[model samples]
Target chain A: MPDLPIILAGVINGLLAGGIYVLVAVGLTLIYGVLHIINFAHGSLLMLAMYAVFFLFKPPVGIDPYLALPIVTGGAFIFGYLVYRWLIGRFNHGRDENILLITLGLSIVIDNAALMFFTGDIQTIDVPYAGRMVELGAAFLPVPKIISFFAALLLCGALGLYMARSDTGKAIRALAKERQGARLVGIDVDKLFAVSYGIGIACLGAAACLLMPTFYVSPTSGHAFVLIAFTTVVLGGMGSFAGAAVGGFIIGITESLGGLLLGEQLGQIGISLIFILILLLRPSGLFGGKG
Target chain B: MSRGTLALCAAGLLAAILYPLVVRGLAGAGVGVSANYLINVGMLVFFVAFIGQSWNIAGGFAGQTSFGHVVFFGTGAYCSTILHVTHGWNPWLAWPVATAAGALVGWAIGALAFRAGLKGSYFALITLAFAEVFRILANSVEFTRGGLGMLIKADQRPENFQFRDPMWIYYLALALCVVSLAIAWQLTRGRFGARLVAIRENEDAARALGIDVYTEKVKVLALSGAMCAAGGTFYAQKYLYIDPSIAFGVDKSVEMLLVSMVGGAGTVFGPLVGSLVLTAINEGTRSLASVVPALKNVQPLSLIVYGAMLILIVARLPDGLMGLFGRRKSGKRHDA
Candidate 1:
């Protein structure tokens, strides 16, 4: 067996990884809470934002990803809003399954479009701080990972504050609780939906910015995150923000420990198994209300 | 079915049966088309249609809507491949066993998921997770070669289930398609199919009406799984190779769903029509890329078109393209 310090390191690494997952799942859960449909395009949209960061950081522009965060996030918000307005909104008239298919189709389009344009090459940004490490008890973590973890937490807290305090957020919550009642009370339900979707995608944009220095972006990068985000969302309860946060951390640690114990190939099974077990047993999630 | 519809189906079948011969004849007469290539294309259409029909059975007819039907496909492929390659079992014999294995897996998943009362997106997500778990296990296990993939020896013989002639595989695929269509026809005409339809419309209502909703769902899933597994066995035998990604990938799931949805879910001829349309689009894009030269790597154009079409179909053509072929119905019944 490995030393306790090594195990502690694994746990630390998992927590850092989970930070990114929390951000991703936060967006997913928000969309689910408000729209009551799984956004299959969540990963693809994140991929697109990653591409945006890549271009902004490349030679001609040479802007830092940190600097590009606001631009990318704003652009993502508008893109998400318009996509909902033009595509997803138009198709939202039937069974919730229709939205699932629509988002899936949207993901396919986005992923393939990325493939055609981005050429499937994995792109990474070279930041001076990339190799820097911070010592935390028994673990030595990358500077980017540490920064991202804190930033992710900060973002989530900010989003929570916004949702609890903002008028638009209240409207969204009202819609989620009762769509017809929200509409009856003079809330512009459709616009609120678009805004909620925009905010969700905007979270992805921030995540992409946070992730680029530490991770690689490829056309299929979205596939890697999609399942993890789903697992996080499901584990945390489908539409609960706090649940997603805790769930992301748990999943991250599970992945790290799973890799440590089962070898990398079999270790990946942990997330999927957790997903299945949660769906089977406590599907409402750890802190979620009735599913 | 109407007399007109029956006549249309007959004409279509006759055309399909004659297609290979006609292509070969034209090629012999020095036509532009390659008989081998066209024949292979025909085989692909039917193969895709067959698998799509499997998905349609559970997802459409029974309203299960799984995002991971490829689990059964991969299970069948790996099961038969392992038995034939490692255990020295004849693939012809292993084929049925693999199919049964698929059915067992289907029943197990159905039992667990249905018992949990997991419906809609929760059910879909759980199935996807199961596929992921299977994929990871296949990647880690020593028996599956740990992602090096398993390859059957190229012993080209009829007895080994490996055909020297591509035509044999084509015929096999065509037979499978016909069988799938017959099964779908049975579903439409039988009490079980009606119960499934009732369940799909409303589970509580179906239960109130005395339908064993859970049992029927499980049964349809088993049937669907068996059919898909058989396709997997055929795929392995035809290609003589099995890999984790090729067998259990999400792409296959998307393709199956795309075909059924675009063609018309819950309709008998939906998968066939969808497969043909998609294959045409795929080939058209490939040839178009070749012609344009500058668009040489624009191969994803076809899938982009498919994705767009899926969105359009769900938005506007809920009944799918098959809906266009059939008359507008007065009620919820969409059988064509």
Candidate 2:
């Protein structure tokens, strides 16, 4: 028989992990769907957002980190737009290797710039409810983790609805599926690409803000979650929204369960191994359409 | 080959070989020689060059950009360290074992990733995930000594391959660099290289032409892994220490890619030149920091510089520094 408390704790952590993974993977999936590029800088952008919220919440402003989410997201959106217009747009139809290399270089620049500004010290917000826990029978769940989990679910659901019903969203999807058809239909492909990039960055920015309540903010902290996000994206099938969501939960659970069974370190290794195995077994992903 | 080119190569080799002797003579004449600093930079150059060449096997040749190469490097370092520290095996004996381990790991990853039809960004993501997994596992294992790191026995012995002189380590690293370049050059000019290029150009076409895409990719990945493992072993031996952060770090993987890209990916001499240039920049930056106190606390400025340089190179000089020299005009014919 399993220990009920341990299992419950795992479940709670899994949910939190799933939420965070979704936040990271959503941007990557969006970039892939729209531009067919991986946006290696996506993780670094998350780092930038974390710092933005961190600074905005400091001292004179005295705004709560969570409250600064809008500002962070807005900043990321603008930054993303600029990046798409100035950097990514220049390389349309370029080789995939070139895109990867360029984005990787961008990631380095963002990460190191953060490091230079913030001095590499790990800084965490001391929110009023930071360490507080809620009791669920025998299991105690952290408050911040619960908020993040629900927040992620709500945001993803909203985004899904917007994409399904909104005019701009439809145009973006149309462009993603068939560029020539979208252009024939009078959709401005360049503007659509920029908007999608902005939205992707905005998602990451919101996630960073949400993450500050639980995790410490550091220049390289994005590196910690970036790989997990990538794993989720792959597990869910590249560019599949629902897949990203489901994959996020699956990965989250795997990490939590593996941690409980093996150890925290082995948990990550186990997740990676499982991700590879899944890729081997199902190339198109569990829920993805055939390539 | 032109006389000038041959003379240049000869001159570079001679200068590298005699640099230590020149420094020693200068020191004997009471002119200060920073032999330690030079050796440190030189070792970095060798390590970066070795990693770049290894990455070029998959990324430059096969056009499969993998972001997780540090996993093999970390594996090699950890395996060699465990063998020597726990099992009392000789470092020389441990090198092949580590390389074998890397090869096996690479084969497994390639088998899974390639079979799934993951390419480009997808492949890079998978590789990055693998590295992260390795890092997490390394950090959690008590046997690895965790974040505290595993330290080798301090008393230096030639038999143990431990050295007090930086020159010994420098020469060893230079030898490794040379060997790695030789292997890369040979592979890039062979039948396998031709097959890799064909696949890179068009997988479907390559398959139509009777190429076994999966097998070839796995083979190249394994070879690359083995080479990287060998490099890692030498790195561990040279430093006399190993840590999860240093061994399995993502930065290490990025450093390799950056060096390769900067020097000119797919070219034989690209990795070596990239490593040398980057290493020089790194050393120059550190020395500059000492001269200017304000710059001392600016963490990751060097990385920022590298990143900016990479972006500039990609945007303006896609062919890199080697392209400017006109060494391999034929390489341009196979642009992705």
Candidate 3:
């Protein structure tokens, strides 16, 4: 076995990675909850956020990554709102596969567009905080990742509170629990759905900010991450906010600890194994009950 | 099937078979574009059609929309190639091995997912997860040569599934496509096919009616897995290349799904129509690239066009191109 310090460090990093998954998965679950459409392009939205962050951090703008979070989140919300209004709204009444196909197509478009425009080269913001590290007694954690983990936790908590407490949040929850019931309650479900999608994407934007400091952005990078996010969301049970938060951290720790136990390659396989088993043993996920 | 529809299918089959001869002649006459069209477009049309058709067995007929058929496709490709390249096994003999391997993997996936009671998008996502895992494994493992991939040299003869003529590959794919279409046709017309379709329409109702939904799903999933692996085998042989990306790429999965969906899911003829349209668009854009020369720099133009077409097909042509060929009532009756 490895040293205790190294294991703790792995767990910390895993938690950070899992934090990102939680945020992204929450968006995915949110969309599925209210809109009842699995947004396949949720990762693409995250990719877009990463790119937006990168552009904003470039020489012309030179904004700090943390400072750019609100801008990216707000922009992503509007972007998602328009996506629903223009593209997804057209197929709302069709079979679930139609939305699935459209989102898959949209992902292809955005990913390829990024490929052409960004030239498929990995992009990252050269933030000064990247080099900074904080000693946590047992092991040192990178400043950016540590910051990102806390930020992710804070955002997830805030979103959870909003969903649990706010009027629109309750409306969104109500819609997820029973669409027709929410509709009968004089809730403008369509508008709420669009806003929910926006918020979902907004979460992804926030995730991108959390990740841009520690992760490389690429056209195809989002695909793998999307799979992990799906696993996370599914693990937490789709539409379950609390489940997603807990599931994210569980998956995160699973990945990092698995990596520590096995090599990085086999560790990924371990994550997939856990995902498959979780899917099989508890399809409703860790915090979810059957619908 | 109706006499008219049967005739249309027969006529389409004849056209497909005779197509190579015409292209051969055209190429001989130095109408050189026919050469590219024959090999690239024609081969891919048949190849993708076969895949879409195989996928249709489970996805269309049984209402199991698997988003990750490429795992089995890649498995077949890798199985055959690895058997041939590493073990010095004859490629022709490797077909059964690959097919069995594909079916085994498919059965495992189906049994697990079905046993878990995964439905709709979750089922699809699980399959995709499996494929990604396979891709990653293929990328990491030394036996598969990792991401650098493995190539079969030209020195191997027909026994090894290599041929000097490019048209042989096209014909092989075409023959496979024809046989698959025949199989799909017969199956769709039979009681087993009806059971599959019944499952597609309503699983709970079918279960209540004493249809063994689980077994039927796993069986078709395995059968289609074998069929798709056959396509993968041809892909590896004809391309003389096998890689994790080429074998298990999400694009390949999307291509399979799109072709079936665009052709007409749950219909035997749908994939044929869909693949032809998709191949035509692909070749059309490709030829345009050569003509404009500048279009080559655009790189991902074909993908962009295909993606747009998928969206358009989903939005407008809900039933796919097959909808245009059949009457509304017959199509509806045939589907549900």
Top candidate by TM-score? 1
Model 3: residues with Cα > 4 Å off, grouped in runs: B32-37, B329-336
TM-score of chain A of each: 0.98, 0.96, 0.95
Q: So what's the TM-score on candidate 3?
A: 0.94
* Model number with the top lDDT: 1
Clashing pairs in 1: none
Q: Rank all candidate structures by their lDDT, best first, as comma-separated numbers.
A: 1, 3, 2
Better of 1 and 3 by DockQ: 1
lDDT string, candidate 3, B118-140, tens digits:
87677887888898889889988
Instruction: Arrange candidates, best TM-score first.
Output: 1, 3, 2
Instruction: Say what the RMSD of model 2 is.
Output: 2.2
List the TM-score for candidate 3's chain B.
Answer: 0.93
Q: TM-score, each model?
A: 0.98, 0.94, 0.94
CA lDDT of B162 in candidate 3?
A: 84
DockQ of each: 0.64, 0.60, 0.54
CAPRI-wise, candidate 2 is medium
DockQ of 2: 0.60
